[model samples]
Target chain A: MDKKKPKKVFVQGAIPPEKIANSVANHQSKTNIGAHSIFLGQVRADEVDGKTVTAIDYTAYEEMAENVFHEIREAAFAKFDITCAHIYHSLGKVNVGELCLFVFTSSAHRRIAIEATNFFVEEIKAKVPVFGKEIFEDETHQWKVNK
Target chain B: MKVTVKYFGLVAEAADKSEEVIELSEVLTASELKKQCLEGLAITDKDSVQIAVNQNLDDAITIKDGDEVALLPPFAGG
Candidate 1:
């Protein structure tokens, strides 16, 4: 057991600076992983109708969101040959151009890592109960799925 | 029959929460069921919102007694 095995699913606020390095170490430790693939989603500061996006307010139908996320993880594991997969999504406020989600997959080969990362992200977007409210610099807001 | 109705997204905020039970005297078509829900909430019936029966999407199918119905708001999920 050279590699880390997380018991609890991590759905928390933005991943802190130190946590990112720890996550990398967790997957790469003497585990003979041939490939590690990651997907990072960042908030955009692009102007919508001349109003810049300042931040995003994240919320979820918590019970349903957790169940949906957990189910997606299980399905991905069954569908891919990866040894481990981790998904982190932000709750509460996230600033412009900050990372909101990080999905990591480790496999004995590159193909599985690439495929599993895509599958998990797509399913999580379409199926989960997570919702985001885009707050413009001008103070207006629009609710949208955090795809 | 009394069945559970679940709301979603913005509509859930308007109607408060996502799940609640409503009573009906008899079976109603999916469209008619929408009307009853709005009546309960004192809003005029709007066809724009989607409907689902027993977790399956609306099929213009008539719902029978003891059938579960869910009223879904416009989808804004990503």
Candidate 2:
């Protein structure tokens, strides 16, 4: 069943690790889902020049981003045979080593679930209008570009 | 024609403003307006910036009245 509504995917600050556990726990009743593939994006504490990155402040054109996310989800469902999927991305400031993105896809088989998850991740990186400002230890910042 | 122009990421930083409502006395293509907007800004890589008209990433379309235009820098989402 295709749900016409776009699911909310943005979370303020970091994505709690416990949320992943709770999500897994909530899907227990879906016995038909034989495989669940998960992907977590963590903020890296990268050493740049002499300054170290401390956190990433995320901002987005929310209205457009949500619409693009909806399109991505719809495309993923049309391209794969997945039972269900969930995507979460962090907004605001997320500290280093914290989770920024979580994508979970469940399907009857492992291949479909894994493929769908990959598709979602790739599309999000390329399509979504989310911006990141990498704040350094010295309070200086630089805009992050996805490569 | 009236249009709401939004700036995001580096473009916002360069413009020193997030959004603005501008009245376009003359019609312009998305690319032409983008060039006009970037004229005095400090952005070096014009090719990296993308212009979206009415939230649709189509530069070929001519912008008309009451359109929402966005100047989007490179996407950094995960």
Model 2: per-residue Cα lDDT over B1-78, one tens digit each:
899999999999999999999989888999999998888999878789999998998898899998999999999997
TM-scores of chain B alone in all candidate structures, in the order given: 0.74, 0.96
Q: Which is the leading candidate under TM-score? A: 2
Clash list (residue pairs), candidate 2: none
Please give, for residues B9-67, the per-residue lDDT of candidate 1 as tens digits: 55566687778887878868888887777655633335545667765565477887666
Best by lDDT: 2
Give the DockQ-based CAPRI class for model 2: high
Task: Provide the global lDDT of candidate 1 against the true structure.
Answer: 0.70
Model 2, C-alpha of B14: deviation from truth (Å): 0.7
Global lDDT of model 2: 0.94
DockQ category of candidate 1: acceptable
For residues A7-87, write the lDDT of model 1, one tens digit per residue: 343455565656667888866664778998888877778677778889877766555556667778778877988878887
Worst 10 residues of 2 chain A by lDDT: A1-10
